[model samples]
Target: MNTIKNHIGINIFSKAILMMVLLYSFMTVSARNLKVESPNGKISVQVFNENNTENAKWFLKVNYFNDGKMAETISSIDLGLILSDGISFTDMKLLKSSKPLLIKENYTMPHGKSLQRHNTGNEVVFTFENKEKKKLDVIIRVYNDGMAFRYSLSGKGNFTVQDELTSYSINQETTRWAEKWNPANEGLYSSMVGEKIQQEEWCYPTLFQTKDNNCWFLLHESAVDGSYCGSKLSNKEDKNKYKITFPDPKDGRGKGESLPKISLPWKSPWRVIIIGNLNDIVASTLVDDVAPPSVIKNTDWIKPGAVSWNYWSSNHGTKDFKTVCEFADLAVAMDWPYTLLDWEWDSMGNGGNLEDALKYIHSKGIKPLMWYNSGGEHTWVSSTPKDRMLTHENRVEEFTKLKKLGVAGVKVDFFESEKQDMIQYYLDILEDAAQFEMMVYFHGCLVPRGWAKTYPNLMTYEAVRGAEWYNNGPEFTATAPVHNTILPFTRNVVGSMDYTPVTFTNSQFPHLTSYGHELALSVVFESALQHFADRPEGYYELPDEPKKFMREVPTSWDETQLLQGFPGKDVVMARRKNNVWYVGGINGENIEKNINIKFDFLDKHNKYKLRLIKDGKHDKQLVTDDSVIESADSVDVKVLRRGGFAAVIFSIIN
Candidate 1:
């Protein structure tokens, strides 16, 4: 009897000890924190399981250097997705977490805010499994300027993405600058308190400023390819969260499906948040850094420069051959390398046919860009040369014809959709255009998604409410001043913005912005194919000083810096090309003010020669001045209401 009791006691004790050990092991594996930090250690990201409920939920926290210590900028951002088969990644169990890997690389772009870029970040991957036993991996990367994360999935069959449950949650009330959602992405950015924001769709590259720490952050996406449709921020105001939303079924004029259909082993586009000061938002190339490198091996033929555009001056300009030649002449007189012949070229007859116009334009030592309507069911505009780029075979035939005709590039317009098929259309055109050694620009399209890095031939995208609105209605005149000031902080921060800037004369409607303000657009806006919107007569009438400045201004930059100012109030920007720096400033208010100009961006030990053009005593008048200054010097510049100023500074070399 004693031996039996002793044996039973030993068995119970051993079983209890084994059960505790197994429970400890499961808890240790199930709940843990994974972290990655920026190279500079200024930014850090943490991912962890929040609870141990039957349906698990993971959260992310992003911290940045605020005041004197690292502080939380993003409190709790939910990260996950769901598939059509009801496989919920939102309810997942941790499988494994990889060690943080150092990612560093140096790459150069043909033309952008910065030609040379050093990309460095620390990356970590967290693997998880759902109730269905499907695998999902979340990859997180933290850079000095920002942080990004993406989802990866693996399976053996095709799957449809029902929806993404990922969302950004802001803990504090902050000031936000966001554009109302539109397929063409042509809305103006409006400033509002975070609590007052409407529960609606919003555009990417949105700007926000924290009230507590004064930290600035931008929300945008990168690496959006044909496999996924472009997404927008769908605000859930009551919850203080912004969810990732696919296009509506009514998008593309109700043409194709909005949700993404994919094969196994798929990765979603990166959800990027640029964090830090104003300078960090303006000067960072985080967009291109996250995108794939250039796939076009031989990029020698791709040249980015100023262009003389005709559509702004006359809506039907390209239909008349005489007008086409005049625009080409304008390009030559300005020493611009390219001229654009806009819509209706197929109906050319006044001076010559389409071929004859191209011949005359080429004879003047200039390349010409032609416009085509991106035809399908999307737009009602019946512009000619339509339906030529809808199919791959059609694109090949048209691109082949254009290549043989000595055309430099094509400005394909009227995309107006964020559907997967339309996204594929964009990539197909870019790939085909590159095959023929032709450059491409998109007009009436969605905002850029960092595709320029992958296709250098993609020079510019017109996704802003640009100068063309001057021809559309009277509303643009009143809104032009504030709108111009906001773009440098929002839309233009992501990619090349082809605003077609620099218009000095009236189009269909008069501009309320001052002449000085018009001149400043050349520097404030960055585009590989910078379009000069004025007619030949308008530019020819300018004084020698202003004309010379416009003639020599570069469309591309080696470096860019935000000197000072704020959104919807004013802006001062400095851009460098080779050794010379171009500085531009604008006043968004209706009252005149004196702005302090700083030369601290230049070399402190050396002096620079400054050539400045600013508003005179009145808004319509202009004045030019020349001076010499060093980095320690500052100047008080007077600008009229709705006026601006531009300056050229270069080192005084011995």
Candidate 2:
């Protein structure tokens, strides 16, 4: 009887030991490392999970390569969010990951950097669940030029997105260019080392150069519609670790909630990270790739072109009928498609009235663009045409009147918010403008987030410290040169920028850049309705070469290439419209240099006529020359300090 009892005890002890071992094995299996790679295998995203009884977390590691060799790694990126239900996903467990799926898209964007874009990539969806059994999905896309990820939540009822815990851990040794956070997004970009950056709110499209300077990345978001709030980056928690943050409660005149409140079955905008060299960053269409496809099927009415604007030279010019007609004549003279009648058109008087001005503009066979205040107390300037676009009813009424008058588009100004409500307001205006078959240009507004493709009528947006700043104060004079060079790598990458460029003369203050620099801007900057900032006299007085260049330069391009140079120092960019290529280069430093421009991108089988214009001995003079060249040829042109150049190359063999 004693032997039998001992045998039973031993059997029970073995069973207990087996159960414990099985539990340990199950926990260990839950921890996983999932990865997805770009098509060329040059970039990869590896997700690391730590799942245990004591600790559970999910983060991402982004790896980049150069010449098939590992160049750098964005070490750790924390990801998750919380809803109003008090359920935090910061410690959620990864349930499973889907196999890599292929994504291929071919689309056309007439107003973008490249008219024809191909979005090819691989995507993986990682599913996770919190303790409450609520599910969340993190969908990642890996493209040849970049990568993006977004959080998705699904259910039935409404929920407030209380917080987002997404953070990017950039290496402290990296170099970066970021602007201070502001609703208008009009600020200068400052280049600095990652560790030395101030712990402040930074705007989107923040640029980073790896510690080795072998790779580049631009951090921005896309597909931000009414359902979401626009975001900025903050490093206050830990400098060098930039975390996504929503708009300030003080923005939009302190009118709307900063934290987004929405219903279930929703997804956040893609947190886009475009990575590669300067050429890749300049030519990548990843922003438009992830954006929602066009909602307007009939795109026949949309046209991108250059415009003659009045505000830069004459602030109150729109109120004078004669001045409005003068700008209209300038548009016709320059072969521009449209002329803008800015501010106070409702009270036009001199020589005639607003009706007479519109009639005169139409008689010149040029379309007219009108401006209006965005309304509400968001702006201090009590500009006229206010309160006419606040509601959909008002927009329809106003747009209807403008449409009947044959207006080409409307420039809406003074939108000082990025909250969900303001975001919705922007969409509403776009929708209304499209309904009337009129294009839209947003000024005093937020930067583009792939909206131009979704709403093709969105001609351009003024979200940079553009030439208009020359009229505002003396600060622009000191910063404009470097600012111009940095924009091609930063702001202008994502979409069309209405910089109101090309001013050969002074506004309220003088520009320190040369005439060659001013001429280069007409090519360097891309805008659907490229606004010529100078007055009629400023452009009419230009020498034949510069005037002819401005008159013929196209606003939209079929292709774009970054030949050489660095941010805030200099840049040489080439843009192609059809078979002709327009090249623009700028020297941002305070000393002269020789910029070697290669014509290697041209058709090698054909000889071409190159009309080259460069800065002369003085900041105010320009020199022009013509030559026949082939793809193998290169020109070493001297560029003056705070100066630039522009060249037009077309096939001469034809």
Across 1-654, the per-residue lDDT of candidate 2 in tens digits comes to 999999999999999988788666545545444788999988899887545542367888898888866866578788999879787887776777898999999998858788898988999998887888788899999999999999988887787889889999988888889999988999999888944677889987899998877889999999998888999999888888999999999997788889998777899999999999999999998998999988788888888899998889888989888888889999999999899989999999879987888899999998999998999866665898998998999998998899889988999999888999999999999988888898999999988899988998998999999999998899999999999999999999988899999898898998999999989998888888899889999888888999899899999999999999799999998999999999999989999999888888988899999999999999888899999999999999999998999999999856
Clash counts for the predictions, in order: 0, 0
**What TM value does model 2 have?**
0.96
Please list the C-alpha lDDT of all candidates, in the order they appear: 0.88, 0.89
- Candidate 2 runs further than 4 Å off: 1-33, 50-55
Tell me, by lDDT, which candidate is best: 2
Tens-digit lDDT track of model 1 for 1-654: 999999999999999999888666657765565677899888888876667643488888888886676656878788888778777887777777898898898988898888998889999998887888888999998998999899998767777889888888865477789898998889989887755766678888789887674588899999999888889998855435878899988877888888988777789999999988988999988888889999999888989999998889899889999999999999999999999989999999896999999899889999999999999998777899899988889999999999988999999999878888898999999999999999999998988888999999999999999999999989998999999999999999999999988888899988888889989989999999999988999899888888998999999899999999799999999999999999989999999989999898889889899999999987667799999999999999999898999999999987
Model 1, position 524, has a per-residue lDDT of 92
lDDT of 1: 0.88
Query: Clash pairs of candidate 2?
Result: none
